[model samples]
Target chain A: MLQNVPTRQTIEAAHMLIAPYIHRTPVLTSAFLNNLSGTNLYFKPENLQKIGAFKARGGLNAILSLTKEQLRNGVTTHSSGNHAQAIAFAAAKVGAKAYIVMPENSPQVKISAVKDYGAEIIFCMNTPEERERNVQEVIARTGATFIHPFNNYEVIAGQATAAAELISDAGVRLDAIFAPVGGGGLLSGTGLSAHYFSPGTRVYAGEPEGAADAVLSFRSGKIERAPYVKTIADGLLTYLGDKTLPLIREHVADIFTVSDTEIIAAMQYLWERMKLVVEPSGAVALAALLKNREAFTGKNVGIILSGGNVDLARLPFGKEV
Target chain B: MLQNVPTRQTIEAAHMLIAPYIHRTPVLTSAFLNNLSGTNLYFKPENLQKIGAFKARGGLNAILSLTKEQLRNGVTTHSSGNHAQAIAFAAAKVGAKAYIVMPENSPQVKISAVKDYGAEIIFCMNTPEERERNVQEVIARTGATFIHPFNNYEVIAGQATAAAELISDAGVRLDAIFAPVGGGGLLSGTGLSAHYFSPGTRVYAGEPEGAADAVLSFRSGKIERAPYVKTIADGLLTYLGDKTLPLIREHVADIFTVSDTEIIAAMQYLWERMKLVVEPSGAVALAALLKNREAFTGKNVGIILSGGNVDLARLPFGKEV
Candidate 1:
């Protein structure tokens, strides 16, 4: 029965599997924020996690859970930045090497971060087919384990560990939780977390207005795609993966969208007022709360701050892309 | 003996006074940062405090300790920003009126925050004498007790509560601690904290190169002033106050300085890498370690993150001045 559910056991195992590699990021609460929202908001700051994101948990857990034979061969993955870095760091931690494929236009800061973790970088064409082909070729040549960034049970369970920690750390039963849905990895994990820890807790997904694939999928009761995805939250630009969608459908209660302007403004508010430096993707949950303040007022809400990996050199401040 | 000594008695009293009003901010440590610096660095995140800064401790302690007679009479003080907000918030918490004398050119965001805390704003000339005169005049007119922002014994002792909490929370004996020094409110308390909790621990004051008054004062064994102070760390603009100087002189081991560029870089590093939003003043301690990496390479060092009350609009990015 618990197989379909995200139990403390799975989260605990994921935690143990990724303990040495990933951060047990702090769950920070603010009376000031609580008073402002008329709600007790507990923020699980995964932004502070290693690789400056929660991708580390899934990436590390997946690499650690791999067979010794898989380690002997190596590991390969494709990503824009954070996932690549996460897998690279995990590979390094497990005494194995990683072959990471990336687009040429990826931020130098992210590229440098992945390189610093001793991952072999492969520049590839910025298309799904191209990335898949390159990754498959790496797997073929080196017999390396191809680690999916989000569409895998071990990865989803790994991401769920954040929610488990948040619930346990806060030591309170939350009324609801808001998590940003990218490929639905975090949502699947966080949704399962709410189901397991606080069964009555409602799990809502925050999506970028321009990239509301999760929202469409949840409302239609089927996997749906955003027409030509475009958002400043680069991490949330992906279409839902096959493994993530099914789990998300079973657990996610609702989904909401926030504007790009709202995202930046929310980021600024967190930085200036709350003293939290959250990246655009991580700011989505707070942005949704700010935009739809009426819906969540006076409720006990948990917001998972997904990541903080902004390249300061290329801040989207003045000119609109 | 108590004239220049910060006893446990003062800290106890301060804790009692401010316990109900100020926040017991979290102390977050990173194995990542520890590995990078080769030091067991415990960050007492005062950035998470009520007013987004540690000044709230001193401000609340002083306000709460006021006699019934003093409360009815009101209180007056002059500050740059964070302390102003802290004092205003403290006064409001205790149902007392506050008159805060602030420089005319202070940031609008800080000014609005102080005003929002229910303090009567008094715009004064930027000169120290002018600000003091304005504060005194307000006190005379309103029969208000003068609440010196950082010079008072109550304020210094109140700030000590943070160090006490840090020691209790971290549960580790620190070899040394680096705290930012401006009016010496934090350093005085930090010095006394070392004396009370871990007497063998040394407390070092971190200052900006532009505002190296405390460094000169510590070396000369006498109170000294910077020739002319101008740094991105707006909070560290003040010279060490009379009450704090003696306490620091007796307890503090040494003082170090870092450049403005180093401060900004540290702020960026913490925000981007550590996912912390620290002001330039707060980054000085870490900057000292980064600038002189060899000196602190294998030591167990504690750094008190003084505040995160940064105005993102005016994030001192590139310009020196």
Candidate 2:
């Protein structure tokens, strides 16, 4: 099943296909952060990407790859976060209707974002089984193409474009690239990009300590599930998918698990020093680097700021000066 | 006194002088924002500038313009905001001591930022008279040169670099540019840049309704002071100076006053759509544009995001998810 998966060529093609739609988001560097970590860090700010996340890349690529006949009926996905907005935005851009199945308890902010993109909302129970069932039902009823958030080959290929741009835009070889792992779409895509475009660059996954399944699976050489998922990095709550696991195992150098406290601190650092409004999951990669500063000291590191679709009202540090 | 003030040539020279020290901050565009305003808006994100404000440009240029004899004694400034950090950073870069006179009520976060840059802190009462007296005392004791936050010629020249970059970087002739006016440094500089770099472009000043001194001054053809300052845009509380007034009158096209509520709403809009962490002062320009959408419909407009040095703990929107 993994043999026919997306390679470097697929990512390159996706990059071209989505070039007109997406922004080549800027690469920002902070002297204060560099001095603190003793590393030359280049941040690929996908937080500034379309739909405020790298999910836009994958969503657009997947939707654009669909046949005219498939697009005629529309597309459907189940997500309570950035991917839902990504699909809605991508579908709108491609002139296709999107039916998004989100948990009823989804944040009003995320729900409104999807609605703003003109997607039809289908609310379901807050469980993987319910979401999957609802997504299937919608697809079956409408004959809409089901675009998996992070577990599909084309989505993975689309995500790889971010890393491709990072390397080419930075115009320097990165010693290591770190990305947050949730369903592993970004991490796997990062790995493939490093493997193909900049072979010498090592790829690492930053996982929340509460959701350490990705790290455990990478170490045990088997698929693993989180015993419990509870972290302020809300975007990294999901476990890895089968499509992403093999790619991570083959090309990823290591997986680092960081506590919620560390994630918050990294977010604060980004907010204060870099003046960037990155969401918790977006700061995970920097959290890992800051936690293990010795490992990346004096090296050129590339960090992917995954997204910035944060609930401003519920900031981690609370609402007080 | 205004006769020897900075012109466009001085701004171009300042840009060259501070080229190595300051960041040529990025100009970001949002399709979402464009659609909402019905204008093609280009955002000069000076919030990402060193010290998290365009103040860095003026502070650095002012400090660097000092003679060796002046540098030997050091620099002094009275500021409780981004200007304090800017002077500290600029002094450090120029290998000179910075004596910063900040109010005792200054936020701890800002105080720490100044301290971190190795500037000597002199606390005074939170009043203009007290701040001035303390700054004078510091200058007398250290024989340091005073770098006025926004009134000085070099500082005005430094601020103009942002507009210069925007016009050149965007590679388009803007119909008009909007900049928030506090002491009129940014607005004056923006006016000068438009006068020189983009001759056909018009410069508009965005003033807080609570601090409408600039707008009043513009309308009356004379300097004016705010009767009372009470706005979320704390950075724009200061009145315009003699040096800045001359330049503003000579080059600025108009001034628009926006209410505090509108400023907060615009700030929220930028946060949601642009994923930018701009302070209240930074949002004032966008607020004016949004308020008078008819004036700029389908026209190319440039907005200068003045800074991002807000006390994050006390966000405008209450802490309720």
Candidate 3:
């Protein structure tokens, strides 16, 4: 079992356990982008992961860790987005009942996906307190285990495997790896992957300026609220947790904040040049690297494209469909 | 040098010759897509090709075949799309001058890409007749050789390599291979590849109902024009040439026509389910397969996603930016 924070052995074991359930997502490159940014960029496209996000990794790991008896009681999680789908998908895969607490305002596509996975949906008022309260009710009623979206050790260990694969597959001694910081699950997990697998490589983070909690937490050495939250990178609007913050503080070298415009431009370049369908949050790490290109000119950098769940009806780039 | 129709040896040789330049693009698959359509689907994403199209293969092969004596005068072609960019890019790579005749109303994105490649663009009226006239004028003035977009044997051989790569890369024996027909460059090449390499795999084509000339030609046993040319699948508008027509006629088993609505739906499925940024023309093959899903149930099918070069300002599924 993983402790408060995952160790190298736990993470490796988690990777081996979850190997059949997840894709060893390829590391993509664009020479045109490398030239435009003046740095060799390696993209680990988790956008192509099952359920269109790396949340699938954590969701699968956490669910898979449950005892068969516990799994029969079902699993519960509160997310109106990717984590909802991830939990629903993972639970169904293991023949466990899944009760998902979602905001009433969750997008139709997300709701449809969760429904398709045979998870019971418990809609709540669109607030953290309301969602958690609803999840507690589900737990009380069904004895469903509440899986934390990011703060759990088993989940973090699973997320770490993506970075581990990149380290092995990129075919270069990556100088640094970058990932978008939301609740710090992927970033901290990525940081630990570097710590254990490639000690020489540093891990940095990209946080949206609109929802810049991770940077504040990094400096203050504790979980902190964002000054404001108004970014198009909606997947990155949460604060880091106790378990995630400490790991990030210890393992992450720095945090760079980028504007929504910068993120959109990076996404456009990815769509046009690389023919990749990446969302705003997915493009944030590349945006941050491009913004600070001078600091690491000609260096090899690995970026984890976090997800691809853009609302086609309301694309960020143009007028609504 | 190989003559008229490319044999297995010539296609193999073309693959070897262009190995240094073109991407041996990966064959992608989606289990969700397979379940929905009731068929095992393998996608050859030529959209991730060098110039974002398989045209790069044909252009590079055709240009490389030109001797120094012929190349000094430069090469000319008439296209307002991927072929134009491919010719320019290939010519620029080999230090040869390229004169491209494009439609006066060519999309800004296409114009910018050609300009970026250092090609001399001569804009003509948006008609095949006018474009050919301008190509002739450029050739007469500069003594450059005119490279027909699809008619030339070398270009067909180049296009064939993408299908050949798919046959090699897609582990299971494919029951059928599908591609959209435009000038028939890629479809004919794909047909030849199947004929030589995977003899059991039947070749089929998807044509947009709006630009339904290829099916007309296949039935009539001659070159024929579409009754009307209007579809979001802009890449499949052109009719087949003499060389491509004969090859397609002999090798292809059937042709299926899909409506614009079907094409758009298939494109959306690819974007949402597969996380692939494919253009409407690129999605046409899958559209045809889905429309005729009964005929292909439980069969392993290969679809060549032809390109991913949509103008973001004018996406097919949404309101104009």
Candidate 4:
């Protein structure tokens, strides 16, 4: 069933609830990037957000909105990315136990960050069925509420605030705003905010060619898995959620699919030119904008840099052709 | 003869003169860093400045302060670093030709940046005598006015504005301000600004142990060269100038020498936590502060990150043992 889409008022409430916990991340601009892309780009750096991703907003909101009984038990989620850190951080804030299940092969950096947040980790096999089974076991054992990374209503409401801020803060009207689509949490939230707040501002999604499920879903008006999932954008490997898909289909103007090489090159531009330590997923929106520059030329563009949690030792810069 | 120190009014004027040409550069802080270091650090990221360094402030001030006839003849400088790109960018802004004398083995990233700014490159052997000879040749051929990298009065005035801005913008009064010393242009300027603008705020300098001349000069009451200079802080290889030493002795509280290991570690913290892409030279002051965290335990500290122009292909992160 498609969940009821959040009202603009619900997002405003979520913004107030999470404001003290999350950073009012700066909207950064680059003249060099603007000149290169032939568009004025306003980058809202969520990489500088707590837990180094936009996941902080949703995670904080979801945990903060939980009932006292729910808090008494704890919160649990299964992930191997920024969402895990976000959940751990948010749970710790409320003095609740956070039990996070993760893929056995998660990056050491990410595992260490979640552990640092005092989250109890339960390793699972790297598959949807295995992750679900592990989460069910954790919930059954601890009586903890499972916080869905994106599909939850409160989490979607929380994610909406980032775009609401941009729409309200950007001095001029942006022609379009682009964000990377993973589980469609951020992209769906961004689409909804842009639709309700500034109806004229079109929302766009940048899906990795390796994880091209969102593009298929957008075209077919339903959730569809990619032909194959193999991209450097680790944060964006998930297909769109059922709740997120309908909102995306309604609000997103288009979804652009970019290659891994394009994502790495865009990451390099952000690292070298803008001095931002963005992850591959954080750079996908920018890669999308640059790849199809003609469509955005001379337009005031808003590119939401999603995260900055890459293993610095293994930067894909040397892979640049 | 000791050079007359620039008054606060001179720095104010430099701030106004170069306001259009340079980024005011944000004062950023990380709670994670504050908790780890046991002190509050306000980072002025001049790495985001035009030409990607604080040298833009000095170079632009020097060129803009020049007479029309001087600009008509053009400008020249010797640097294999940010200063080369700064002079090139500054001269290009004023429609004057810039002749930069750089070592033959200068990094291609910096070389290409200078070239991108339309500067005429004259390569010299990696020796002080050869560099001087090349600058002289450039001056003899182009009839360009030689803009000394750090030892000039106007350059010092220009560099002072960064600290002046930090003091004015930081809301809370900084207990102390720290900057890395190369030829002491930025340090002397910072010292003079702090002494005049906020008399209670102490000034300190961070010098690479590999290029530890400033510490000796501070003690001996005269300029001195390092016993043997070798450090990854490539921007801080030069000793203090006659023009800069007197101001340092008058205004600076002390100089701290740090190893390359400390510099890289501090840089890693900035990259991972604060998400700033700082170069080795830029991280030196923070290294000094971190190495001596106890002394600044409760103090509000101001750290000037000088530059962020680094070769991405050759990041020294692997040497972090």
Can you give the DockQ of every candidate in the order shown? 0.53, 0.52, 0.50, 0.55
Fnat of each candidate = 0.62, 0.49, 0.53, 0.57
| CAPRI quality of model 1 | medium
lDDT (Cα, tens digit) per residue for candidate 2, span B272-308: 7777889999999999999988989999999999998
The residue ranges of model 2 lying beyond 4 angstroms of the native Cα positions read A318-321, B319-321
Worst 10 residues of 1 chain A by lDDT: A312-321
Q: Model 4, A298: alpha-carbon shift in Å? A: 1.1
CAPRI grade of model 4: medium
Best by TM-score: 2
Candidate-wise lDDT, in order: 0.83, 0.91, 0.90, 0.91
lDDT score of residue A20 within candidate 4:
90
- Write model 3 residue lDDT over A1-321, tens digit each, in one string: 124678899899989888888877878888788888898999999988999999999999999999988998999999987889999999989999999999999988889999999999999999989998999999999999999989998889889999999999999999999999999889989999999999989899999999999999999987899999999998998899989999998999999999999999888887888888898999999999999988888999999998988876566676211
- Comparing 1 with 2 on TM-score, the higher-scoring candidate is 2
* Model 3 misplacement above 4 A: A1-4, A319-321, B1-3, B318-321
Cα lDDT, model 2, residue A136: 92
Summarize candidate 1's per-residue lDDT along B192-276 as a digit string, tens digits.
9889988888888789999989888877767799977889987898888667787888899888898998888877777777778
lDDT tens digits by residue: candidate 3, B155-236: 9999999999999999999999999999999999999999999998999999999999999999999899999989989888
The TM-scores, one per candidate, come to 0.95, 0.97, 0.96, 0.96
Q: What overall lDDT, based on C-alpha atoms, would model 1 receive against the true structure?
A: 0.83
TM-score of decoy 3:
0.96
| Candidate 1 residue-wise lDDT at A184 | 89
Per-residue lDDT of model 4, residues B1-321, tens digit only: 663568778888988999998877768778788998899999998887877789999999999999999999999999999889889999999999999999999977788889988999999898999999988887888789999999999999999999999999887999999999999999999998998899899999899999999999999988898988899999999989999999999899999999998999988887888777899999999999999989999899999999888878878887322
